[model samples]
Target: MRLSARSQRLLSLVALLLALLSALLGGWGYVNDSAAVLLAAPLPLLIVLAFVFGLSQPDADD
Candidate 1:
């Protein structure tokens, strides 16, 4: 199933917000020496990168 253009944009925005939050947490973790928080940070970033890449690709229908 295909998402509407608006929905896709919304999802992208949300993913970006999550990425920003992750970065902030990662920085805080680094300062606090929290290994768990540091390790968790990359996951959201990877997810956001994957999402943005997927959005950038042409759809099969196109």
Candidate 2:
């Protein structure tokens, strides 16, 4: 798949936010001693993967 540079940048930003949210969730879970929130680890990982894929794609014009 190919994506324009602008779209790739946007996706990367979103992915960064997802990772931040995941970290926050883990912190909250730690504070409250809950394992459930920490279980959401895979979600951010998936987002990061998507970000990597987006970066790997060529621009539409290329």
RMSD of each: 5.1, 4.4
Question: Which regions of candidate 1 are displaced past 4 Å?
Answer: 29-62
lDDT digits (tens) for residues 1-62 of candidate 1: 44566776776676667556656766666435365455455666656665775678677898
**Can you write out model 2's per-residue Cα lDDT over 3-62, one digit (the tens) per residue?**
677876776677567567766766766434244345444656767666677778867799
For all predicted structures, in order, the TM-scores are 0.47, 0.47
Cα misplacement distance, residue 11 of candidate 1 (Å): 0.8
The superposed Cα distance between candidate 1 and the true structure at residue 43, in angstroms, equals 6.4
Q: What clash pairs does model 2 have?
A: none
The CA lDDT of each predicted structure is 0.62, 0.64
Error of 2 at 2 (Å): 1.4
